[model samples]
Target: MTGTLEIRGLGRNFGGLKALEDISVTLAPGEILGVIGPNGAGKTTLFNTISGVFRPSAGTVSLDGRIISRMRPDQIARLGVGRTFQSTTVFPETTVRETLERARSFLTAHSPMAWLGSFGQRAAGHSVDRVLKRIGLDGMADSEAISLAYGFQKILGIGMALVQRPRLLLMDEPAAGLNSSEKIEVTNLIRGIRDEYGIGILLVEHDMKMVMGLCDRVQVISYGRHVAIGTPEEVRTNSDVIDAYLGKDHELA
Candidate 1:
């Protein structure tokens, strides 16, 4: 599979308000694309429209050339599009292992007889183990999700998404609440996810350092309209992008 996600002339409206207008971008396998804008610029609205939280008022979204603009969220996920929200979403009472097991359930055979069979249990367990190790949570598999440090919780969120084995990951804000050290750790993890797992990532982040350092390309928006699209340096230097989003004093490097 090419694992490409393409959005064409996408737009969304809320009653009389145009939340997003004619936004378009393509994410290739293993590439990281950053989306940024000031508050109320419709970044989240765009994500919602693409991810099935809200159907678009115009245009289409496709995965590997299959039109998926009308598919439901679960249908979208089953097609290998995984996502992490802006807020933490781990089950606080569940162990790290259990959390992953729940995510693995979506891919496992769901027939009662299959679930009752030993083979199914072993398959799920194996998948969970692999994800735990990949996300650096193997040592904490038995720990309650809520008991982990905040940084670990965020990693767990990514693990939950990883268990789905997605070709494309939509990360809302991976570094939103992290300290400097935690942000660095998450940044490295994001790179590792792309380089090692070969998954395309669409990151919506406010951390300019992380965005500039990691994204292969960036699409900037303002008032729900596309303002800039280019390499990180290109967007950073664009006067319109600086004026609409990045302040005059902001540095790309």
Candidate 2:
């Protein structure tokens, strides 16, 4: 079944600081939803709450109609949710193929003994090869992850997530630190992940060009509260969104 993620009346607090307040959003199957806000708008906090890194102070998170707000991070991941950090997360010393194999191993077997078995080893290898091809890193399979260019390293992060065959992907600034050409490649890859693999995407990005071009719907937040939610064009012209986050000079055109 195509996966659906739903967050309802979610809130989070750090001591007296309310990081997120009554934030709610839904990601339907095969949809690409963008979340954007100025710094301290609670974007990362919201992601943490939904991804099970932090439990919400209030409200519930559900995946495919099952409650997941209280689940552990690994539990949520196993339930078809995958995520990438804003900062790069990769094993610098590991080869591309080895990294993907490790990710695949998580799905096939948890114990070292199980992974050492011939059947599990063969299965993980096959999955790793497929992920390498999917992320355009097949040629670099044997190369150390740290040896790749920055953009390719970011792509490898995506590949790591893909090896899990997730139903939903939460990307925190996939285009961050990327050059123009690299950003274009990432945009295409994100679209392909949604259209070809049927995975729903929830993207958090500061790059208006990518957000406006790639997202089907945009959600804007300010001071831990949702200010606007609509299509890219609608959000661009929205007075609340402009006043809260996007300035007048930030053209969506």
Candidate 3:
């Protein structure tokens, strides 16, 4: 089944600080939804909440019509959800293939005795090969993950999530540290994931060009509130969105 994510009235409170409140949004299968706001706008909190890294003080997160808000992170991950951090965090000392194989263990886990008896999982190994190919690192499987160029390292982060074959991918600033051309590569990679695999994507990005060009719709937040949502053009002209990004002193031009 195509994975659809629904967040309803999501709220998170750290003591008196409300990082997110009453934030609601839905991601349909194969849709790329961009979430953008200034720093501290709670974009990371939202992603964390959805990924089960943090439990919401209120509201619920659902995937494929099942409640996942209360599930453990590994449980949520096993339920066809994947996440890439804002930073390109990978196994610095591990080869690309080994990294993926280890990540794949999250989904294809076995008893330790069984693992000892059969060290190789043919299917999981094949899956890692497919992910390496998809992320354009098939030839570099034996290279240390950290040895790749920075952009390729970011791509490896995507591969780490993709190795699980998730139906929904939560990507936090996939283009954060890339040059213009590298940004284009990430844009294409995101679009290709949606088009080719039909994975729903929830993207948090500060790069307006990538978000505007890649997302089917955009959601804007301010001070933990979901302020605006619509097509990129619609959000581009929205006054609240303008204020959120540019401040009230300036107007959208």
Count: clashes, candidate 2: 0
List the candidates' TM-scores in order: 0.93, 0.93, 0.91
Tell how far residue 234 is off in model 1, in angstroms: 0.6
Cα-based lDDT for every prediction: 0.88, 0.87, 0.86
Candidate that beats the other on lDDT, 1 or 2, i.e. the better one: 1
In model 1, residue pairs whose N, Cα or C atoms come closer than 3 Å (at least 3 residues apart or on different chains), thus clashing, are none
> Lowest-scoring 10 consecutive residues by lDDT in candidate 1?
106-115
- Misplaced by over 4 Å in model 2 are 85-89, 111-120
lDDT of 3 by residue, 32-127 (tens): 999998889999999999999999999999997899999998889888889974555455689989988878776667434346435547667778
Highest lDDT model number: 1
The local lDDT score (0 to 100) that residue 239 gets in candidate 2 is 90
TM-score of 3: 0.91
**Model 1, 144-179: lDDT tens per residue?**
887889889889889888887788999998998899
lDDT of 2 by residue, 1-253 (tens): 4589999999999999999999889999899999999999998888888899999999999999999999999889888889864445356688888877777667556544474688766766777787787778899899887788999989988988888778899998899999999999999999988887888999999899999999999999998998999999999989998899888767566
Residue ranges of candidate 3 with Cα displaced over 4 Å: 85-89, 110-120, 247-253
